[model samples]
Target: MRTIKPVQMRSPVLTVRRVDTYHAITVVAPGVAERFRAGQFVAVAVGGDTSSMLARRAFFIHDVKPDYGGTVEFVFEVRGRGTSWLSECRSRDLLDVTGPLGRPFPLPRDPVNCVLVGDGHGASPLFPLAHTLRRRGCRVDFVLGAAGAQRVFGALAARRVGETATFATRDGSLGLRGRVTDALPQVIEDARADVVYGVGPLPVLRTVTAIAAKYGVPAQVAVEERMACGIGLCMTCVLPVVGDDGVTRMLRSCVDGPVFRGEQVRFDDVGTIPFDALGAPGWKARPDDSASTEIGQ
Candidate 1:
């Protein structure tokens, strides 16, 4: 079992950079930096102390460094009011951050050929994971895609870390003109990948999972779901998943996963509860009607 040390701190922003389609912020957060693993996320309290936004914004940790005791970095696009406020933040500004949360990507014990797939800003987490794999003597191949070149995150970095890096863009601004899945088959075949790891939008992840299955390679996917609380209490990010015991249940993405084996998830039934799930209507045992009727008589 893994122990997580979560801390709520007013971390000082060390640096901020405006990447093509998003903003990357580095903060002086020792606890998060020291404890963070690839695929875990941080929940940041946006709009400062008196602001009206009650929920925290979640972001995947892009990187962590040893600088300033420790520093954690995350990248985000301004999709809404919360992220807009985060984008306007300047260096030395104090922001409330809670983090090192969620299950990290499980790594293989022995070195193997691995292919990593990411789409848009979802590519952030793959760099650190690739670094770890390379350290273990694993050959890492990267397949990254976006609508255009600017939308592609970590292209140069992926090239630097991976043994072979392939890109796909919808508008033909970079590499191939298609989705990541379009480029995946050739990359996997050429690399002779033994396993696959992916993080991205639901559609992209589903496609990646399908491709990996067709190739007979195992896949692990980190899903990007809309999280309101970033914790398990809200029950807002639940999705239907099958367990090892052959039962299906609604699992919270924030706690139960964000990372799950590709085969275990029923991608077609993600948004709605399956009729056969444990707690679904008519699935649970009902009280005996005869006993109740006799008491009433």
Candidate 2:
């Protein structure tokens, strides 16, 4: 039971490096670094003090190190103005960061064979997760995929941490000539994976969930949704999820989870509220519309 504390800090950038397809930044935020767990993320205010970018950019914690007391690192692609601003960050520049947010990936109570699946920059969180899993005596395997060679985040790191690591690329520039899902079944079978953990785009998660289900292996997924307020107040990152009580409701990814039991999520209806979901309009409507009849009638 890890308690989450919401900390806001102005931390100095320790270092910034241009990875093949993304920028990696290390910031001296001891509070965040000490408390961070896999799947938790940080919301960074970009564009400096005078810039107009009000929305904080969210990134999964790539790694944490005990330097300058403690430091946290995150990786991201320069997808837009916010990230572009982040890219220009240099050593000693201060960044306003809010973090150690969101529920972390749950490690099993007993050691089990686990397969981690990540795609593109989404692979950021898997490294630390692998370390934790390995320390707990779990046999870890990795299946990482990207559009091309440079886009793959941690092939070398994966090999270092994982018992077995497999890579895939859409352009055949890597280990396999397909998506991660294409190589998943073989990996799962070879590893005799007892469970799976995945973090990536929704489509990739959906596929991983489906494959895990097919093999009767449990799957946990961390969704990558655009979050405005990582603290969950905004309700901007809601997605339909089915609870154990068998009711489907919109859950906020920021708080309720960015990580969830794969089978419990309505992946196909993520963007649209399902007609039968709890609290949905007309969800309890009578088949004959008798409930709408006037009392006088």
lDDT of 2 at 214: 99
Give a tens-digit lDDT track for model 1, residues 1-297.
466867888999999999898999999999899888888999899998999999998899999999999999999999999999999999999999998878788899999999999999998998889998999999999999999999999999999999999999999999999998999999999999999999998888889999999999988898899888888889888877777655677888777777888777888998888987767886753353221111000
Model 2, position 156: C-alpha lDDT score: 91
Candidate 2: misplaced stretches above 4 Å?
A: 285-297
Question: Total backbone clashes of model 2?
Answer: 0
The digit string of per-residue lDDT tens for model 2 on 34-57 reads 889998999999999998888898
Q: What is the C-alpha lDDT of each candidate?
A: 0.88, 0.90
| Top lDDT hit | 2
Cα deviation of 103, candidate 2, in Å: 0.6
Q: RMSD of each candidate?
A: 6.3, 5.8
- Those runs of model 1 whose alpha carbons end farther than 4 Å from true positions after fitting are 284-297
User: Could you tally the backbone clashes for each prediction?
Assistant: 0, 0
TM-score of each: 0.94, 0.94
lDDT of 2: 0.90
Q: How accurate is candidate 1 locally (lDDT)?
A: 0.88
Instruction: Write out the backbone clash pairs for model 2.
Output: none
**Model 2: per-residue Cα lDDT at residue 71:** 97
